[model samples]
Target chain A: MRGIRIGVCLLGLALALGAQDQANIVITGSRKYQMAVPDFNALPGVAPDVRATFDQVLWNDLYESAVVNLVGRSLYTAPAPQSEADLDSAGFRQAWSEPPLNVQRLVFGSMQVNNGGLVVDGYLYDVTQPPGGGRLLARRYADPATTAGARAIAHEFADDIIAALGFGPGIATSQIAFISNRTGHQEVWTMDYDGHNQRQRTNLHSIAYSPRISPDGTKLAFMSSVSGEPQIKLLSLLTNRLLPFPTYKGMAETPAWSPDGKKLAFAADMGGPNIEIYTINVNGTDLKRLTHSHGYDNFAPAWNPKPPPGSPGQIAFVSSRIGLPQIYIMNADGSDQQRLPLGGYAVSPSWSPNGLALAFAWVRTGGGEDSGASDIYLWYFGQQKYVQLTHNEERNDFPSWAPDGRHIVFESGAPYRTQLFTVAADGSVPEQLTSQGSNEMPNWSWH
Target chain B: MKQSTSRYFLTAVTAGSALLFSLGLAGCGHKAVPPPPVPAPAAKPTPAPTVTLSADPTSIESGSSSTLTWTSSNAVKVELNGAAVDLNGNQSVSPTQSTDYQVVATGADGQTANDSVRISVTQPPPPPPPPPAVQPAPSFAESVRDAFFDFDKSDIRPDAQQALDTDAAYLKSNPNVDVEVVGHCDARGSAEYNLALGHRRADAVKNYLVSQGVDASRITTESVGKEDPFCTETTSECYQQNRRGHFVRGQ
Candidate 1:
């Protein structure tokens, strides 16, 4: 790690922060601007404990994908999408369906307890009509390691969502990195999005938090108190060596990597009054400050929807500029501060892979670390509208959007331990994704 | 940064201990100080009676059951409970009905006794099967024993939240079992905390189960913590564990 910055002088800091101006370049494009509800029929998030509730986070994740649409199979009556009033007026005789079920694609699953573990059978269909209308597209099985499965199951659904959308099924088999306090010490953890095969990545005696996976899913950049200061460490998943942000000062908190996987953007005290945002190379060189909000703290960053061959370079982050926390979209550089006043004290702003939408935690009424009640919100760039995803009373925050952009992962301290979660972009499937530990600061990595 | 509080505490304790140790030596009667009348070397301490102890079962699973047994010669009393069991010897050999068993030992010289024998049972191993073929329909109970709040409250009361957790754990492990969690509440608070309680309780159960490996599809939660009364009987003691959540296996 080489090349660092000295934030000792404000004037000097101003000079260095100006260098980031070249990074903020935005582009206008229209492909798919809505959260895609991909079919998660095959995707399984830490499988639900219901021997049969039948609704899965995968379905919800797919719903968020806005790819494949979901019509609850268990809820599907033969003929109609009607209001409760409309349904009653139509009578039980009204074949339950006006909008065709499985019209775009059919995603169905069956769960059963087998030999002490949950055995799930999932199927995908390409339906043009109703009932037996679609041809079988693909199939998969999810046998929770035990009756209790986890985060990996969501990966299962994510896979099906992809397969259902005819994307040749990728990512259904990748891993996500998060933070968990399983060993009595908070450290970096990795588990399938469904919350399974949870393994600790860092075993230092100090508590580790805020794990953000690199674009290629080969590395993780997170904060660790191991060095006696909250410093940033880039960990190689393949190798066990730790790469601390070469000799930076103060605390480095939340972190995000560039789409190219060359640089890391993180928030740190950097010997200042407020925790601000900064970025550096993977080698810890060229330390660049992203913001200069003297007294206000700015953090929670996500690369703006970088797709493959054709991708726009943008960045979305949470900042408390107007006296209240909100989400802002900008160029990779620190310029063109466009605000999407989320209208609430928002934290953990996660940009979708496509950059069309953003997921965040917005505290509605009164509830913080003391009260435990908070909600998650989704901001759609296309609709220019914010949708509430979580209505539960538990405090939910730290959102991490899936590589696909339809799903968001976060952590909450409900009755259960403060752990990770994945919700549909619509916030419908507010499924808890961890067990037995205080898991927080989740960052999604690419497959 | 790694908050190695234990190490920090250890260092502090070590430094304090060193200072105290030195001060203790420094004050160790180095200067001539008159010694107080030493009690006539306490009457030749009577030889205490022999006490023998042995666990009825020496081992047990971390959470399983076990009993202890002990005998003391020339002792008047003894008792047993978990750890060293209890201190009194008045209780009976309540073996069949108790989970933790203990024994005490004592001596009757000026007269008292102490006794202890701790026996722990093993983790209920796939409960000695009904035979090898009938696999236990693995009961996964991912329930929340602590009551959680909604919006703005910080309290974890005990109640149905317990059973609700077991049900959740059970359901989480059995993905095939769809569960409809009906959240209930005792008559109390703004209808809000209760509903929120009910919903929170159910979500607590749902979240716990989901984390435990249960598929989300098999579980759904709702709250009625304050609205649904188990009995209009108007009693707080009876509504203790009932002031929370309930999980019903969904069809």
Candidate 2:
């Protein structure tokens, strides 16, 4: 029996890996999985608003995933199935699988209020299969019966559907940290990937910049002037308090987290004439200098999200060695330094979650001058070419890739009055994410 | 008595004959010589020549050039620095040292008027006083002036060099005083890149001070990027004013 159990586990792992491979193909190819999502049914005692909130959030999450093409509800000729009994009906199957709709998969769910909390039951059906064999996923989620709770339940359900469909992890639960002076002082602020639940994380009362979330989502490393000098400060997200960090002799700014969440790469002068890159442990130990060009300023280091096995990840940073700052890649230990071969002014590089491309702000016309406005560009390593992701935007900068690898969040607008915005990696569907007083420097969470 | 009278008569006759011969020769010449040309109005004195000379940039660096311009009226001839030139013109002059350019205007009546302009040339500062000996310590505001930078540049400009030289001299004399140089940028570039640029500015200042014989340990550097700008206007002059390396007394 033990051997059989082990064999079952191994089989499950193989199936998951196979699904992941198929999902990659779906993402890279021109075709997307055609699926239909009907509004989740409200069982007795479920508030109408709760059901509406869940349905809206779930639909948005799926659409933004960009891995599936959702069929419009206008094409539905019959009512949606809300339970196994309704799903097994021949009429429901015919409506979803018919030529006009031609949906390959269908997702439906039910919501109910129990013990003053919300409970959601979701299922995915492969309509191409026979009615008895169509069910592919079934899961239940529970939360407080509030609007936020309903949204949370919906997000969880959508993430589960995405995972089962073989798309890697979903970004519905990720957050973004940015700088906003809405409180009359520059402070660190965070929001959900969909620009919901904006909350201030730091009350430093002093200016703060570059809030980078840790890989484990437990800490936020940012540069602040709380002590009257700019220094890297680590804050415990779990504890909501500033942690102890060593005070270097010079200025420290623009801290980036290593993938393991164990180290941070930042730029500092250290009582010298040039700002070079350095790495330090999260606990302020094992300080290592990564770059040594004497008179050149090197900064804004971004670690590759995933490096080769048993190898230190590569770091993309801005260097002004050959005049205007340009993107340069070096090993985490500062070896194999090479420019990215892009001309004009390039700064603020952010590595894509897959580590195959870099998203950065580039002024293609002006060489480090204010005469030209900045736009976001992506340099794909494999293709050896660049894709312009923004155009004719006024000073769009600080491009941070979403964990899903399909979206990037950046700050845009005129100087001193900028706001945060998000755009798809393909340069479509630009969305404004912030409208308060002067927001800039958005860093997306790793998860 | 009769003989004397006869001699006087012969002399008078000789004078009369000479005068008649000269008059007959003039009449034979050109239609009676036009009655000896009427001597009528006296001429008005030629107006005194008026001249003005000036230089476009009255002062310049030794190797640089300045333009000398002169305008004169009612003058037949004009000379700049003893060389003939147009009455109303400008000439570029690169003098090796300080020079005074003079313009002389001469009227048709030969009356001359003179005007001059002085162009001051400043030589490059001597290789920063060779490691100045211990001197009296000047106040921070007097000695440590802010070093300005060009847009997105960290290389030391000549003016910046002069400010830093004075700062270096002060730092060398005051061995116990520690200073912090904070770099800044205009609100035009990405915040992250501006931070790096600010650091470059501060570093450049510190390096120049060190090269001038101030101990490196007496100085530190910081970069506030564009967060703490000195000026907030959107003009180029304001941006330039915001981009600087500000010096502060170390805590």
Candidate 3:
């Protein structure tokens, strides 16, 4: 009897552990959590088309998150469970009769139009838990019954679901600003996180490069050769107003806004013969020179979004003082400078939001006869090492990190054209984002 | 008495000339006094164009100005050093070293004449205070052996010391000459970081020179990073050659 009781207790503990999914997600593995997203059931007042649109947008959002390997409805031999009552009645175990539909998680939702607004209710069920009930998370969102609003509502729920799965947050709401020569000149353009609803931001009618969105997302700073020389320009997204940043002597390129949004640091040929790092306030006051190098050109300053404790001020930038260009870290006031132990040509660094790592374009050609092509690399500050995030493919450059610190949007091209591409932080799944025209210098907006 | 004698002589000559004229008119055999013999037509010769060239000061210190004045006569055109000029005018010319100004004049008959003036430019005399012991001027690029560093290092290398030593020795002798130490890097690494690294390399050379009896004030350092490489070839030797601290004499 004692032996039987002990065995029963061990089995019960094992079942409990299995039911509880891991809350902390380590994104560096190949084991993907299988997820199923079915068309949302339309209530009487809701048009079936609206419900279909909601389901489609939500499914795409979850699928593009890159972590969830979705199972399509074609794999299911039986009809999908639409409502909570239906799911409860049929039991979660009967939701899918097909072998592949037995996913770890199942997403089912319902949509309806009520009082001129769209209401969406979504649920995530850990199907491995129990036979009758397997609900892990649920959320309800309402918005005006418009296409854009409905899509936004779905994205909100998807973001919440992603957050519950230990991912930082979904980037569905963020936008990427990049330079595109679609209209005969390189202008700053912004598109939704998934490359939808692209709109031109700056009509400078001139070549623009390196669009940096403010942390608050109200202002955009970019370098434009509009005034016949490259100068930093700030645009107020709220008012559609554009103003030139008061600069000293030479041209300014590569503007990066600080995490606090009070200052803008950029690479400009000012106060010296060569390009050096300078910071100016958003209101065009308090100009400060962060570097005093009169010889070697220093630029591409990326302010750490999250500096380590006791060092609230830290910046990573590219410097060629040694021989080739290498990444260097300095304090906010340009002190305590140290080189990141990376070799070869590294430039255009974009710091991750979490400040644990930086993404940059690097080529490891040791000045031999080989002209090494560039690819994206991630230098993990915590690990004090680098990982080549791209392979020996086309030339890649100008990496920008998404707010979630998971996706990096960069530019890749070979012969006559280049386009924007987004890859997971782990260097997997490089998805081309832009194709119509030559695009370069992609910057992810702050959420 | 002289006036009376001249009046009487004029009257007697007038009567004789009248009798002669009457006799000639009456068909008497008499020789008519011929008018003074007409002078043969004199030939007018074409005048050759004459040119005058002069320099106010034939010899001057280098970079000093001199006045060159020239006048040409009977000339339709005048040119100074292949450039047309006024027939008579003065021009101020500063010959850097020594130069010759030639003036050519063409007369109306297509005849040409030329003259030249030379201005010798000499170095300014040494100061009254006897010059210091003569020493060769420093060769900026040659005197600095490029203060080469190891891969990705800004520290001066042992092999590069000879050049820096020569630079320091020259700098010590010529205390007034200031030099600029420009740092360079190979075409690799982050351009911004390479700039900072290049700065450190130039600073390293400057510091070393200062330590070796060269005045710190005589050295200013800058870095071109990898933007301006000495050698663009992809060879290791080229990269090593590019990673250097070049020397430049400052004004």
Candidate 4:
């Protein structure tokens, strides 16, 4: 009887080990971890403006990451932690009060005015920890008491929290170059990635579009129609001077920079009435024709951000050779061309940084092209399946990827009232980046 | 200890069954992986525009001329690289060398087609014995006239044809003079579009002169678009006067 009991116990242990395979607790699909960010508490002598600015800016930056699901403040049933000292108090127990609220993490901070300057203390805690200790991240920033300085401090702190949580280096420090018509003509205007510090970069006083910032982020290349031809022009950020590229006889537009930044590929009418993809040296030498579509317009060339193994290079471009516009991938030298398995009026192909997927604007067609509205879609090369990122909203086009690879900026509008907007790569939490005037063709900076 | 053993046994049994059920539900274990298809070459869905070019006289004297006409039904716009003519019009071309004029037509559907017409200008049958008398001096200034266009149209208006005819006559009378037709547009729409419209306007003037029996080589064209408006004042009358093709003599 003793031997039988021992045998049963051993059998139970083996079965339990087999059943508790951690991977078996499978989620249907991956999702953002629920995170709660309560408003930062103000120190006894701190001004309300300082507290409000820091809290709002930090929340905006963190929420823009899209990897974390921010919990609403109304659900918080605990007292707000005022300072780092409060972490030692029982009053801060609310940070980990989880159950009814399924938040997995808590973000709280405090701000105070010291010597006419604002000082902020930021913290992030894991809700799964016990009340005594759950500090996952903590940082402090000091800045002049100006509103802009306060906002900058908050952005820096939010970046710290994101990096600590391993969500990739944050995009808060990046900038976006977009075409805006605020000065009565379409010119290149740049602003902080979150839509602050907007200033005009080009005053061509003519129409310009497709502003692509170089990898070094010092120069901008765009297609301007000021010289009576749709020609590619470059603007120096250091000097604010506009330099025209070597003149091609026909119209030139849609300038794309190669990953190495040594070459610019654009659509030119060099061969025929319809444009073809052509690559020219940055100094405008060694012009090479990449496509011969037999008079079918092949424009909008987007070089792959990362090249695959055993190939010179690869590019994702939109070609209208099949009667309808579709995304096509080809070697950089224009060989081994094949179309993506998509059927629609698709254009504006932007390759993801990892080269695993392509984000493009697609207007679904039902035997005819004019009926459907344009929306952004992601085509996963690995899965060979696509998911629509935007649905039945305003027409969203020109989906350019952010440097972090987790976000995309695109133009959204009907016709005359277009604005720039940024969204997560998986298509969530779209934040309007520009609203003052008509903005379009936003290209995220490489850094 | 005995109770703990019973509880462990119960939990193990439940978890083991759940694992087995999930594995069974997964079937072949990969719902997301589908058979990959070999990429094939893209299908060519449609052909480019079809064009035809024919020279009216097919041959001309060394200094004389012949008309070259083209017809393209599928195309919305046609371009003669060096010569300016409408989508379906004729131009009297007198090439010093035997010249082949290629016309490319771009359809509204974005397909292009091209054709060429060669005009054989005969080598002047051994330079005719010269007439000993002196020729009259080249005349200008009075014959150079401004031609107007309709709102945005580049075609020569019925009223503007008279001025163009006078300019054509002056060029015919003085074969030694070569002129440039400068095109302009009013301040409206996009600058680039205006530039293109301006070029078309100048080209239309050159084509009209060529059809009126002026040597095509003697007329060059340029478009300043809305940049060099003849009238800078912001008024409807000024804009109307600015939309014109001006004639200028080469130095």
Best by DockQ: 2
TM-score, first chain, each model: 0.65, 0.92, 0.87, 0.82
Which lDDT value does model 2 have at B75?
A: 89
Candidate 4 per-residue C-alpha lDDT over A159-229 given as tens digits, one digit per residue, 9 for 90 to 100: 77777776666778788999898888888999888999998998888758678888788788898878756
Model 3 DockQ reads: 0.11
Clash tally, candidates in order:
115, 0, 30, 0
Runs in model 2 deviating more than 4 A are: A1-29, B1-145, B162-181, B206-221, B231-235, B247-251
Query: Which of candidates 1 and 3 is the stronger one according to lDDT?
Result: 3
- Winner by DockQ between candidate 3 and candidate 2: 2
Off by over 4 Å in 1: A1-161, A167-171, A307-312, A321-324, A365-372, A414-416, A427-430, B1-251
Which candidate tops lDDT? Answer: 2
| TM-scores, each model vs. reference | 0.45, 0.72, 0.60, 0.59
Question: For residues B171-205, what per-residue lDDT tens digits would candidate 2 score against the true structure?
Answer: 87778889999999988777877877887788889
Candidate 1: TM-score of chain A is 0.65
Which residue pairs come into collision in candidate 4?
none
**Top model number, TM-score:** 2
Candidate 2 TM-score over all chains jointly: 0.72
Q: Candidate 3 chain A: worst 10 consecutive residues by lDDT?
A: A1-10
Measured over all alpha carbons after superposition, the RMSD of each candidate to the real structure, in angstroms, is 33.9, 20.8, 17.5, 46.4
The lDDT of model 3 is 0.74
Please write out the lDDT profile of model 1 over residues B133-232, one tens digit for every residue: 8655644343324343332221234443455456555555555667776666553222222333354455556666566567777776544444335564
